[model samples]
Target: MSTPRHTLAQLCAAVTAAPVLLVAPAAVAAPQAPPPSTVIGGERLGLPGVQVDPLAGAPALPTDLTGESWIVSDATSGDVLASYNPHARLPPASTLKILFADTVLPKFDRNAVHRVADEEIQNIGAGSSLVGIKENLDYRVEDLWRGVFLSSGNDAVHVLSHMNGGIQPTVDEMQSKADALQARDTTVVSPDGYDRDGQLSSAYDLSLFARSGLRNADFRMYCATREAMFPGAVDKNTGQRSSFGIANTDRLLGKYPGLIGVKNGTTTNAGSTFVGAAERDGRTLLVTVMHPASYQRVYDETAELLDWGFASAGKVRPVGRLVEEKQAGGEQPSGQAGGTAGAPPPHPAGAPAGPVAGSAGDDGLGPVGWSAVLVGALVGAGAVVVLRRRTANRAGRLWK
Candidate 1:
């Protein structure tokens, strides 16, 4: 345990030499914008150093992905493996919950109980999904979480908002949390991801949010659950009491080995969106698609990405511990105050210049601030990102 001490001169020389090597690389390849061919929206998009094979045999990817944008990333490393117009604006449907889930998971008190409110059920209007939560009935916080992920209940989201105070306050908190996590391209207008007029998020942004969600151990467990049995309870309203089962909307569970929970979303306008994960051997993959053509499209597209990701060269192997711990401190969710700051400003809302196809952000900033805590819970994001960057390099392509 005794130290091999460095002399004063040795310390000084080590510091000086380190900067020379670090600064030299930057000076040689100054942060210049990428070329036009690589610029899709406005971001520099290319796998600068990924090792990809042009002739690598991959499953036939569907050209007509119903989704306007999609992404597949290595969950362990947060690297994008493949994408389709990932930055294009498309309806997120319930996938919006990924953000809400990330924002609210930190606020959860597993022992705290919550009661469904009348206002929570009011004004959801048409097309809203509900778990049929009885007004004035109380449930454990963990049960509410199941309702949110397994059922995709709009009412459950509203109830969470009520628990956090009110809808506007909850939405505001969610937005603030989003900015803190630095999901810059994401603008949230609803809690349950029911598309409102102004609410929007890019495929890249979803990837970032997914990355954040994977940070929570509790959250990860909830998402992976295929079904849950409701606690015995009676409806306060109409005195109609019943027990209901919550089933996960994600189709990939059990179908794919090593698959875990995240969330799934769909709406008429937003089409179908899915965020799911799987660990094969040790490597994990996070796959997401927004506004897919049909229910099956989400499944097929995700499968394609997973197939390509596993077969890609230099695929990162998952170890016993989570990857963030090896590189950063704890995996902080959206609300955490850790991560690199001075990341420049975010892309202004409606900035006509869009991000490049594979470039993380078109706003000139690199890898927007994300809570490692969130990424850990949603382990898929880290794994996906890790593999994505590697695959991108091989393809001479990159994705946000």
Candidate 2:
């Protein structure tokens, strides 16, 4: 079945207090950012400046680090190695596309085709990036995804957003997806991630989005790809098609060793933002940098963070975890990002295991399940006594 479609403006209209709200963000300077987020990941994460456990001989944190918000975490264990203003809400620019992809990527087959409509491309914000999507041109779902990952194309995003039923519903679903990931700091106002009055995300939330998105095979493939061909306008007379090349906007895609493609974003209000993932020695590290000192620093600082995170190894203790519990849907993690295929989650360090713990009659809910069973057993005993007394009375005999 095909999804119904709605215009991108409809989403903001559904959420926005007034149409006048949109006019000011673009015409004037970005307003002063709101207060820092109330720290969702851990106790130490809420503190300002750099955060790292003091471990003997650990590599020093990058001295030049200047992002307003950032986090580095182990993708498998979900442990946050370190952070700086991790919960600070700021404009995400295109990095929010990661969440958009997380919400909408699984809905359609890659080979499915759609012809662009005049309305689909309507209302992409001013100064928005483009991959040259033209009305009346047909594109495969795979190519559209490439446009999103590689070119950071707003046009491509809108078309897909429409195909998913409409802009309003897509935004709603994206918000729902964010909540599902426990990304408490995100507010989705625009699906293409263009700057808007209420649209925002945190470094922590962005990292979560990247880690969750990495679990999908297709998402991994698209983000890792450096280049792909996009369809050109059809020649009306010849009835032929030509293709144009599009390369990934991420600067570290080819330069950084062991780096996996994630995402990059820049906008007037957001400055520069990025979320990067890399795998080394069966461990994957996720890094997110938002509102760096300059356009270049976002990538440079990200590389430094990645280098420090890899080298820290046993030297630094984890401050907290990205998610404390799994919700069991939409790219559910297999516990370890690099676990042996289908291996169960590793037991907590020093926690009891083996036959003894199992013999305690654990239903995985631990003491809570046992408590319920104990209450049930006592209630059953009482019911048996009451039934015996009632039968004796009815038969004209009594015994206790």
Candidate 2: tens digits of C-alpha lDDT, residues 50-135? 77895999988988888998899999888899998887889999999999999999999999999999999999999999999999
Candidate 2 local Cα displacement, residue 296, angstroms: 0.6
lDDT of 2: 0.79
- List lDDT for all candidates, in order: 0.63, 0.79
Model 1, residue 307: what's the lDDT?
Answer: 73
Top candidate when judged by lDDT against the true structure:
2
Residue 281 lDDT in candidate 1 = 77
TM-score of 1: 0.65
For model 1, residues 1-400, the per-residue Cα lDDT tens digits are 2333656566456545555432222212212333323222223211121212223354444455566566667766665556655556666778888888887878878778877767877877487887767777888888888888888989788888888888888788777766655455567888888878878876766766776787788878888889997654665687765777778878887787778767788787777888777778788777777766678888887877677677763643221111121122424544323223223332433332334543434322233312221232133324434443443343332222
- Quote each prediction's TM-score: 0.65, 0.73
Model 1: per-residue Cα lDDT at residue 338 = 29
